[model samples]
Target: ATLPGEQLFEQFTKGLELVFGDKPSLGFICGIKEAVREDGATLPGLCCIDAPYQLDEDYWGSEYQCEVDDGLGSLIPNPCERISPYFGKISEESCKVYGGTYCPLTDCTRLQECVAELIDIARNENRTAFANYLLNAPNITDPENSFQCGWAREYFGFPANFINDNQICEDIKQFRNSRDFEFLEEFFNQGSSSDEPGDDDDNFNVVPPLVLVPPDPENRDATEAVSKKAEVQNGQAWRATNFALESAAKTLNSIYDAIKDSKCPCGGPFCVAGDICKLVQNIAQKITVVGLILIETSAEISKFTYGEVAELGNVEPIQTGERVKAIYDNMVLTGNYLQRRFQGVNDYLERMENRLVRALAPPSAPGPAPETVASPSNPNITFVVRNGVGCDGLDQDGDSVEDNCEEDRFPPSLRLTSKASTSFVCEVDYCLEERFRTQTEAITFLNAVFDVVDDCSAPEFVQKVIEQIPGTVCEKTRFEIIPVQTFPENSTCADVTLPGISAIVELGLDTSAPTVLCGFQVDRSDDDRRVSPDSKTLVIPSERKSSFVDTLLFQTTADNCPGPLRRMVTVQSNEFVYGTNSVVLINQENTEDGSVVPRLFVNPQSCADGSQDDATICDPDPVSDFRFYEVKISVTDAVGNEAVDTCRVIVEPSRRRNLAKQTKDSQRSSSESGKGSKKIIPIEELLLKVAESNVRYTLATVTSEVSPSPVA
Candidate 1:
């Protein structure tokens, strides 16, 4: 549970200065209100703390007075004063007692800007790591936006509420009762968070405020009762979350059932509904898994028989926060996708309904019959074809010419081709006869537009572009995203060198990408050959972290390209093969040159956890006779040109931990050979001893019984 934004920041900032022994030069999350982002989606509250605002020290400090103006508990300073500027290096006074240094962040504005950039980068992943960095960053000018420092928490005292029973003195309790503690109970003690969260979302989520008031040490019963109550409450909340997740899963299954049971003329495995059901099932299963993880993580926070909130301690409140964040993020993504899908389904159903309504309509009495010609289309009514782009085999442009003419080539640079043209507008309109039946439609035309379809048929971008297009005749619009591939000419796969580090490094990406008339292909390699399940190379989707090929970067030089795709280096190794995360022997002799005019790539696969799976390939320790692997890199340009090359990877090797232990064992064996060593005892002797002991035990039992009778 957390307090409102303003109150949360106040407490957090107070903890920093009051507990951590500093003048508090950070934390300016002032305004808490809903903010809309550029994408038109309304997110959480915006915290424009970096922007200049009138500092209201009196408002927060209020009449609630404290005995001392000291520590993080000191009055909130002016907006500018919230940050202290320093330059050059960390001063000795700024260093931690045990010795940790931080470059003073004197320029508050610059620091905030840098921090914001970091937060943006983290929005997609691992925000906790960035938060930890900001919590204890060194004072330094962040021109490049990289701030990292290590310091022990011991350097700063725990917050007043965070301190244990022994640490809280009567004087401190009295001071807290009179001052800062008032706000923790009443959220703001003044105002609440903004209901409309903006683009600059600052976790405006409302949670139960902390009920912090030191218990009477002498009143043991009251303390135990409070502790028990808290334990039960926390457990209840956790259990409720689990129950909600189960309910959601059941609901999704129910939805899938409805979709499955729906009538469809076509029948194969699951008809048209199977794909949707599969997607929903995947999301439901994952949601359940993440929910279970969230519950388990929250439960592990305390093993206390009763309860305690003495300090943050090993209690990873951040993890709990992140788990919620992950859940929300996944749920949002899945919900959005499902919504779009259902919307498409609704549109199709609506079209069908309109058709049926038209079919059943009453005819006009004694209308004049117009002269009609026996044409392929319905000649009863005059029809003029509208102009539009086309890729499918039909005169979509309304020109007398058939499929050969692609009137408005999109990607304007895409040329007409005999086969595999990937240039089509997101949506286009053309006049058609009422007699036209959807069943007569080609697989690509019907499947690609307004229906869940294959990538080649519809592609990912078509729907996006189509949605953005306005003022279109809804009945005639056709959507498709096509990127045509042309044969490559004079193309060369450049020799590239990548940084050999545990960190992800891009291979000479800027210079090494395939250069052709059209765009190129870049993919991860495996076994000295280009990584491709089919003839077409896999296109890298997004930037990812890896020791080797993170993604295959594909670019089309045609008039239309979907912006630049970022690439991350995949850690290549030989040992961590076949998805096994274990130390294993390397095949030193399996070296092959896959340079057939076609390039070989050394694309190594990674474990789900993003670690190099092959322990033998990239061993970190020094060992003699290191083995190298080859990878084939190949690219087929937008124009039918193809180029391939082979690259070698020098995988670092390590002697397994067993080597040192084995050496010690050998030395001990040699030493023991000269000294007296015990011989191995046979099992027959042990069996005889066991038999003798059993007989003695029987005799003793009888004697004891007889002796006991003497008392009687």
Candidate 2:
């Protein structure tokens, strides 16, 4: 349901008015509602209206004749007088709300005097002094804080009700009462200074430096010491990322210079063919800009971390922790990625320079040997050489052994691989124990490292500019461990005590994405239980049904990273039937004929098998003169949520048994032959005879029989 065009315009005008002010004019926008004269007479539609207005009450709204210049270059006279009082008019107060200085004509005497003093004060005084003066002025009421006005009351202070409710006072109060008052104050105080000291050209266009404001202690739930330490760590991470960007910038500039120096026109000794030089130059420029944009993105991301970092100490912390952790992780990962890219480009340029030198060298002498630029390796990571990896000739690990060679001496370890086949073995022994802890602080430091072995390098440049360095194929195994209860919360021998009775459930996981390796650590009061070899499935004997409740702990490897242990609870009951909703009567005999019929129970067949000697009742004495028993069935999910339904079972005699009892008469008597007992031939068969005489006789006999009944 969408609002009509007029209604939508009215609502939008109302909201805009709340943000700015009613009756404030700026070009097309006039008053929030329809314009009216001083006598309360409504003005005509848009074309006839005079929209320009002033604060002075003597300036009564009026209508004026007008003409519009159509785009086709002809002046068309308006059909009606324009009565709107705000077209093309600008409001000084609205301009101030938008952070623009508004200068009005001196001829507007009343408004000039009214706002002249405040305008002078704003220009002469600093923001703090002006805000203080507004807040503490006499005859001015403090701003209201009522929440009924929505964000207007929350983000901005209520307008001060000064003498006569001057509009300027409200704007001042809003500034003083805003949540961003401190930021605005800092902007006004320090943002005005010249970029280079002692040189003042009034370059007000310069954006202010980013200021990090520590959140309130109440929000963070941290001691003063811990808060200070977190701040220090935050600053350090930022500086390190900034330094990486700076180095990247320098490398891009150097690359750009080298490309420019190598460029030459065609037919020259050093000339490069085609657009290769132009292409390389373009790539260098794009990469430089990309680095710059990343730096800006890093700054923007830092701002989002304030509230997220504070949310770490909240009782429910996973979502916030993941968000903040991603920031730190991305920073580190991007730093490493940039380092790899810069190094690759530098190595390419060095080789090109050496090639040029060889080309210019004397033909009698051989070219110098190319330098072997080894790939940089992280200290936190270990490497292993394996067989049948990519690019058989290259030694990626610098071990002088090709990755495809089978006789590698390195030991097998957990390897983290990227989409590009860049593999490294990361041994973070502590991450396994602490990664899944509910406490965000447990993994904060490690998450900040970014280089912590994970699948962070899955995204790669698709363009040819990205070097296609041959990398080793990574061989690593990862699995997710899930603990599953083999039975319901409360169950007897029928559920799991029987052989081959184990609860199987799907956890609704993406089985195709990650391998699931399941195992369990069971803790139960009963000793009479059996566990599967993998420790994932548990079974308890019928005798130990009463105490089969167990807690199972599980651990898993989260693809290229360490995950924490998870716990699941399993329960069993001594009772054969877990619950009974109600007793229902099912007649065992047909009411009309007193015929007996047998019915089967819907519950587990074992519950009705009396030979098992379980608590489940099959046929009980008449309850209210009806012989019946209750059959209960229940289903539970992997997470222990359950639904149960029950029905009554009635017992009766079998109808088949009654029908089998009827005996057959064995005696038989001989009978004498008679005309009435003789078989009679049909008239139609007699008519089919081939002889004409016999056919006529049969027809005559049929006609006589019919005539005897009636002459029809």
lDDT of 1 by residue, 31-142 (tens): 0010100110111111111222223454353322212244687643232211111100112232221122222222123333444455454444323322333333344343
- Compute the lDDT of residue 665 as modeled in candidate 1: 58
Model 2 CA lDDT for position 337? 35
Local accuracy of candidate 2 as per-residue lDDT tens digits, 579-680: 331112122456685432222222211222232224434332221211222323232222222233332222111221122122111111113322123222
Task: Please name the candidate that would achieve the greatest lDDT relative to the true structure.
Answer: 2
lDDT minimum window of 10 residues, candidate 1: 699-708
TM-score of each: 0.19, 0.18
TM-score of predicted structure 2: 0.18
In candidate 2, which residue ranges exceed 4 Å CA deviation?
1-225, 230-242, 267-272, 299-326, 336-712
